[model samples]
Target: MSSTELPESVAAAVDPRVSPVRVAEGETLRSVVLPGLTLAVRSRSATAEGAPPALYVHGLGGSSQNWSALMPLLADRVDGEAVDLPGFGDSPPPDDGDYSVTGHARAVIRLLDAGGRGPVHLFGNSLGGSVATCVAAARPDLVRTLTLVSPALPEIRVQRTAWPTALMAVPGMTGLLGRLSRDWTAEQRTRGILALCYGDPSLVSEEELGHAVREMERRLQLPYFWDAMTRSTRGIVNAYTLGGQHGLWRRAERVLAPTLLVYGGRDQLVAYRMARKASAAFRDSRLLTLPDAGHVAMMEYPREVARACRELIDDYDRS
Candidate 1:
């Protein structure tokens, strides 16, 4: 389908004032309630009638705000929408309390099916990346091209710095950490998160940091915050341990869409070494390596990420 064929609601752009990054100068936010999910969707207002539709999914603990920087850059090329998966962002916890990778993928599929936004350009970072892989694999009909940034694909030897997070899957670890860090302020927790998520924390500006701190504060206030984090962390660990058809790596091999995989040399969570394995797993793929980026390259180097995505879209069109 062409860019000008989108429905008015799908093509409508977001109001910039509500954007956390404010980088999405003309972006707007609207709440979408699908079958069992309620998502906070952000989209740019400048998209022309038929701009190709694209959807962004954030990582485990992240919200739709995570795509604030990248969405606007691609506004002219696609009708971009970033979703706050259930239990994250403004969306409430799932009544069923299933935070497995499959559960997340199901939520995404339900939304896409309901909106009839199949064969879209799908983007995901970290945990969201893993979920996107599942979506593209299970329902190739819904995906046109796939882009992954630091996907939480399995690694035999997980990184040392990521151990704490991976350990959250262990029974009682969540309560233990809560007791251990009870005295820590929100700012301290935010700083620690930035240190782990960003290759060079210094790259983030004061304004951005302030916005992030405030967001962290808001997230902490949610009643299901810790439950969601622990359950999702466990889900990722479970995905990593699977070895057959349900395994993430095996699923990655099933993805039929042309894929773009981005990795950061300084990523403390996902090993940069897995870049080659990922490239080999996806039948048709390209890899982009950023030596200075951490886990969130789309946010750290959005221009570069946006450029690569556009190139992928161009290549998909040509094919």
Candidate 2:
């Protein structure tokens, strides 16, 4: 789709009164209001006219900015937009307070339906991966191809490192953790997150760290921050317990789109061993394993991810 093809809702929803979030160079940030949810979308200008449309979804506690490094790289190939899921980034909480995987998927469907941007090259990372999986399975007509980076699919033996995140789903745990961490500085919180998500934290530059720290400071001040995190964590935990046809793995098997699965060897949240299982689950899927990267491989190695995504689209076109 051409850049001009973006719907009026995207242009109309921009509210100057809403506090601005950090947008990368060559990217524009806007709000897209659907019925019950208002999403913050970040768009990278397409390098070529008539490029295929693509949408990106960020992981838990993440925003559209997570795709900053990668979106520009693919601008020549796709008209890319990354969404800040409801209650995260600049968006407020959903009206229904439904943070389930299905709820998130529905929000995405609404955006695509409203914009008439179906059959998009859909991309997801971690929690967004789960959300993207559901979108693909439930609405194949809305997706052309799927690219998942360290998707948070169910694991038979949950990793010990991920226990703390899962525990937030328990009632009162979020409040307790909030109280305990209230004294912590945003810099401290940012550092902790970096340690958990990055394979090598040192690779993040001082400026990037500063940006993260500022974003952390912004999120910490939001009254619903902890609630959004806790409920979304619960959503993932709940998704894992689903069985038979409702399970994420089961849904993975149902997705008709050609898939590209990217796994990070050093990811602390999702197990690296599940890469092979994901490859087997998706009927027509390719796997990209970045042994040196962590959970956010798109951020760590955007060029590689972009190359693989390009190949995924090229292969599909050839087919």
Candidate 3:
């Protein structure tokens, strides 16, 4: 769809494809074809001057717009582009229907190679964080530094009270969710989701959340929405449980990039206690605890997140 034709929510989340950030004006929107679908690409001119660029990936059921507000601010400090992971945002689903972490990482690698950015500053959250860790570990050459916000690593054991992930894991739960709320409408689904992700449940305004709710309604109409979500959940559970070399923690240990791990002291999804183990996983990593933030801290406390992101960059650039 044309930029103007896109929904107001989507529009608010990302600049028009023509709006360049860290790249030259001549740069334009491009698509990189992976097995099942294509990734919609956009770039901004190097507003950071000569600084290295960051590559951002959003969590499950999220899109590139998740980074819209933070990008312009960070662009001056570091070049960056955010991506919509397959089946979530604008990106398409995987060929194997494999929503596994490795599957997502492979797609990311393809996007990086196709988009022509090298050794990027990597960032991710939740499912995307797990995928990002896999990418950095599998191909360290492509990542210069790493920043993960509430990344879903392999739990030492399941963190208690993470109801969302727990619900996802319950057999037949999605179908049950779909059946119980099938007639409830997409707007309701979207609002319900936002409430689950945010501890305070007010980070998303009724107006703003209404837009997201509409977006969800439109997307669910697509054939793959439910399947993609189910597969993506399966992928996360599978990748999250991997042992030895294939696990998220093992990959984190292999990541040579200086890493910054951000966790909300109140985050319900990834759990705060797991943050300590995550910090220890990366040899060159340090932890930044957000005492009052929830799962999506960047969205809830944009200013603090921006400051933390800057400090991480400073340390990376200095060392």
Candidate 4:
């Protein structure tokens, strides 16, 4: 098997145009205009007032829809909202194309600050996971509980295979990326992308496929797709190399919110072994391992993941 056979855990890569963005009546997604960027946001229940609301953030190449399953479950008590980090989902790319992890974290923090809900229940996966951790640490006042699903923190054993995505962050790749695929079809992009993100490609339903295909087609039609991809790529890559400083370790140590660190033992992008270090970082935390799951456990096992989240919510309520 090619090293790039891409273990089944990564679903974002299956389709370049794929996004988790849709609207159900009464459900609305509003893009808040912020300095340097705009965020594609969807909200379910926003009236918690004094209760701790939930916030969801997706990883590389992911959109708000990725949390569709988990959001509905938590919406009742959590009053959750998920945002597409600029450049990946329906959200537009940054004005300066500055997609560093800190940059992304700032975007998240700004959104949370604007939400006006104090110290939310935070959930982040992969790249978003790293950003979420950073946000919680930097502004503990804004985060009550943190739930990280396979966060992309630095590891002693980084995947050499993941370097290609990082390379796109280089100065030259952004322009070249746009030129390389002028006439490429959306279906082609989606097929190539999905092949990389999903452990079991067959698990992707037809509707999901159509959504991705259309999203990619829509985004690629614009001139900003490459910019979004490259900038966000740079941000994600820079996050993996914090040089023993404010990386995941330090952030975890400073995070005051009760944390729940989760890992998919079968994940390819992020090695499950790092869970140990993660556990050590959080002063208040627990670990859950999904042996058969891939990169995105919530997507693969929504009910099980939901049950875990409910457990946390119950714990928070009691506190």
lDDT: which candidate is best?
Answer: 2
In model 3, which range of ten residues has the least summed lDDT? 18-27
Report RMSD (Å) for each prediction in the order shown: 5.2, 3.6, 5.3, 8.1
Model 3 scores a C-alpha lDDT of 0.73
Q: For residues 222-251, what per-residue lDDT tens digits would candidate 4 score against the true structure?
A: 556676677777776676666565666787
Every candidate's lDDT: 0.85, 0.90, 0.73, 0.76
Per-residue lDDT tens digits for candidate 2, residues 174-243, read 8898899989999999999999999999999999999999888777767788889999999999999999
Best by TM-score: 2
Alpha-carbon shift of residue 83 in model 3 (angstroms): 1.4
What's model 3's lDDT at 125? 85
In TM-score terms, candidate 4 sits at 0.85
lDDT of 3 by residue, 20-53 (tens): 2222232234445654656655544456468787
**Cand. 2 Cα-lDDT:** 0.90
Prediction-by-prediction clash tally: 12, 1, 9, 16
In order of TM-score, best first, we have: 2, 1, 3, 4
> Model 2 segments beyond 4 Å from truth?
1-19
